[model samples]
Target chain A: MTTSTRVSARRLTKRFGDFTAVDGIDFEVRAGEVFGFLGPNGAGKSSTMRMVGATSDRSGGELSVLGLDPSHHGTQIRSRLGVVPQEDNLDLELSVSDNLYVYGRYFGLPRRQLRGRIAELLEFAQLSERAADKVDNLSGGMKRRLTIARGLINEPELVLLDEPTTGLDPQARHLLWDRLYSLKQDGVTLVLTTHYMDEAEQLCDRLVVMDKGRIIAAGSPRELVDRYVTKEVVELRFPAGQARRAAPRTDGLARRVEVIADRLLLYTDDGDATAEHVASSTLQPVSTLVRRASLEDVFLSLTGRQLDD
Target chain B: MLPTPFRPLSYFWVSFRRTWMSTLSASFFTPLLYLASLGVGLGSLVGHGQRLASLGGEDYLSFVAPALFAGTAMQVAIGQATYEVWGACNPWSGAYRSMQASPISTGQIMAGHMAWIAARALLACALYLAVSAAFGAVKSPEAVAGLAVGPLTGLAFAAPLAAYSVRARHDQPFSLVFRLLMLPLFLFSGTFFPVSQLPVGLRYLAYALPLWHAVELSRSLYAGTFEPLAGSGHVVYLAAVAGAGLLVARRSYEARLSR
Candidate 1:
């Protein structure tokens, strides 16, 4: 086995007794790519990440990280692969930097080399000031950055993050995104799982939207939106049920119009033109806005929900 | 074989350093209390006139010190193997969650934990013996010759228990086994009053526990009753427990850490 390929899986399946967590799924992630698994809770995203991280056994199928089979080369694979699980698993008793140093020593890294790496990683994660502080004292965001710094102690070729920004504040999420984007530029392959549409769209170059342990769709963010939603969407609102009464304005203006709750979605190649057509028609609109379709629209079209819970 | 060329010695040192403070407290405090309270307080109640079956009569403290050493060893070793091991491996504890993602193998973790416990057991047993010596509890100086055997018995018992700890999702299984299986073994393994004082039906458990042979061989050494030819059986039993415990702990570690 070689330290390459980043990630590879074939028919990878995981089951806990009778329940199937990650069904037979196959994929490959090359070096220097940001790949994501999008799915809801218990949809097997974390379970799949566990198997790939070499901490959980797969009931069936072939899997490898860094061109090495996890079952046989677990220590090697783990040494080269950084993993951040759904929870912040930092060592609470130790200083934030000691957590990184102690973990680095486990990989047989000497103190001389480890000290410099620790400094670099701490700075990279923006945790330089918290180096001497105990892990328990840090806020949720600082602890997560510490976990990320620990994962990179070995200078791993690939990093796996399961819901990296699940509970962080908006500012924290943006900071994590900035750090991850730099990692991408540094050529570190990242495999993350998140049900958040915006996080996936922002981080992943390509992603597979998973449901019930299966990938329903796979493509880049723009590609998925284009395939599943129109170029432009119009949101129409009424004070009452007048939107339903003015249905004539929607006819022949677009390919499809779906009504959910109190808003009507107008799907068309040109949203401004559709707005002009509606203004000229018998329909007197209350408000009008046109914007490019997004991953959220794709998810809404596929799953029929504004956002996953 | 380890794929990452894992340094077992390094793992051992780090684990030892991390746990040294706690080990010292348990080793010093637990043994000191039992020896002082039981050997001094309780031994006064049992006196030298007390007869303890085939091993023959002796001072109560001298008679019970070796058995106490063995019993205390089991308690500490098994304690380290179970709760501490469980805490490290459980995802909720986040110890293994952090370590397993590094170069350390599950086996190394299991070994590092048990090895530290074993060393601590030996240290505690030694500390207990030194206190017993100062108290004039020893009938023969040859008893010091067998201080090496005390931790071996613990290692034998702790290994399997450590193995079990790696799989326990909670504390219930160990509680049942300790209360039902281990407690009886401790009481009737010729350690306390006598195995013969127990009901005939319960005598079989004393024979089954590793502690029975441990207590017997220990009393022989402390009382200067060594039999060059006949003592092999007791030695073998302790060896078997040590060997079996180590094997199971190692394998269970592999099961837990290796995907």
Candidate 2:
């Protein structure tokens, strides 16, 4: 592995009895980069994340985190890495600050150093005012923030977040993204798993799109969008049961036409031209919207299914 | 810095601060009330009877106190291990999962869990012994050995029960364990009476349990009748049970947490 590589995996596989959760996949996470695994649920994203975190054993393959083998040096690798699981898993019985304090202790962090660190983390998570409140009493957003803060208590070089914003509202997700962005600014490598395409576009400096236990595509979000999809997309909503029948009429107007439930997506270089073609054509739509291509479209185009589906 | 194996204790210590009042009160009052109602109230009727001979020629109150001490340790340990261990693995309160994500290994987590149970057992048993002393149920200074015996017996149950709890997906199994295994062991393990009073089959079964060995050891020590070989045998037996349980718990924690 290179010096800049924080995590490296080669032909890593994880199997549960008869089921293969993570097929052989190779990826590298560099330092100070926000790397992401973007996939729908059960895409083996979590299994891959757990292996990198050194909490799950790989059935077969070579894996290294922080330049050490996880199979033999899990504790050592984990000591220098932070993990925020998909579920908050905050100790509901303890206060917000106590959660951070106790988690730091698990890393054998000195109590004296942890006190200052806890205060700083609580502030960083915007939970300084609620330090003494029970975790059960905190809102969903506050709990997510505290979970992230707890993950940072050990001052790890790399932090692994599994579906960090899976259940948060828009405002909460934005706040969390800002915190994560600031972590990146401080040069902390972040590896996260999210089914949210926008979240990947917003946070990931580089990412891999996974499906069925394999990394199907890996690149910068803009690269993936530019390589796999058009520059713009036109979304047309037709009358009930009309989207599929209307799909063929707009065939030549766009480079690609996809008929999804109740809507027809026209992928083209100019969404306005596609919309104009559709407006003058025999097909009549209830509504039409033109927008820039995004990771969502890239995922749809690659997998023939929505990212959140 | 604390050693790696004991790191997870900090979590229990922090959480204990919030519920220590109720926990300590229950620990203190449960034995006190049991001693008052059963030992004192019933001892008045049974103390002067020929049945005292079967109880080693001791007052009924003194006879039952040490057994209660050991029994209470088992109760407290199982009580702490069952729900907490289950909750630690459960989705809503994934405390063990949270710890597993850190540098701590599942082995360390298991060790820390048993250590916390031992600590709580020591505290609870100490209070029980003090109450026994106050009630004049403590017959000799050797009775202080109950402290060691208490936590040992507690661990014998806690470690294995924790292993079982780690695999339990729901709370229903816990209540079933309480109703079937724990309750039966608590009642028939010589806590309330001597194994000699039981039938031949039941008596041998009581002798096979960890709590009975603890009760017999505690009773002999409290009555100033401890035999070196017998006491050593009981100690070794309880330790073996606890050691085996810890082994199983470590494996279970590793298997479950690593997933």
Find the candidate with the highest lDDT and give its number.
2
Error of 1 at A256 (Å): 3.3
Alpha-carbon RMSD of each model: 3.8, 1.3
Q: Write the per-residue lDDT of candidate 2 for residues A92-116, one digit (tens) a residue.
A: 8788888888899888889899999
Q: Quick one: RMSD of model 1?
A: 3.8
- Candidate 2's TM-score reads 0.98
TM-score per candidate: 0.86, 0.98
| Cα error of candidate 1 at position B145, Å | 4.9
In angstroms, how far off is A48's CA in candidate 2? 0.5
DockQ of 1: 0.37
Q: In candidate 2 chain A, what residue range of length 10 has the lowest lDDT sum?
A: A244-253
For candidate 1, lDDT tens digit of each residue in B190-258? 886668777887777677778888787777887888887656788887888888878877887777665
lDDT of 2 at A145: 93
Q: Write the per-residue lDDT of candidate 2 for residues B1-259, one digit (tens) a residue.
A: 7788888888889889989999989988998999998889888888552337778888889888988988888988998889988887876667898888887888988888889999999999999999889998998999887789878998999999999898877788888878998888888888787778899999999888898999889999888999999999999999999999999998988888888
Which model scores highest in DockQ? 2
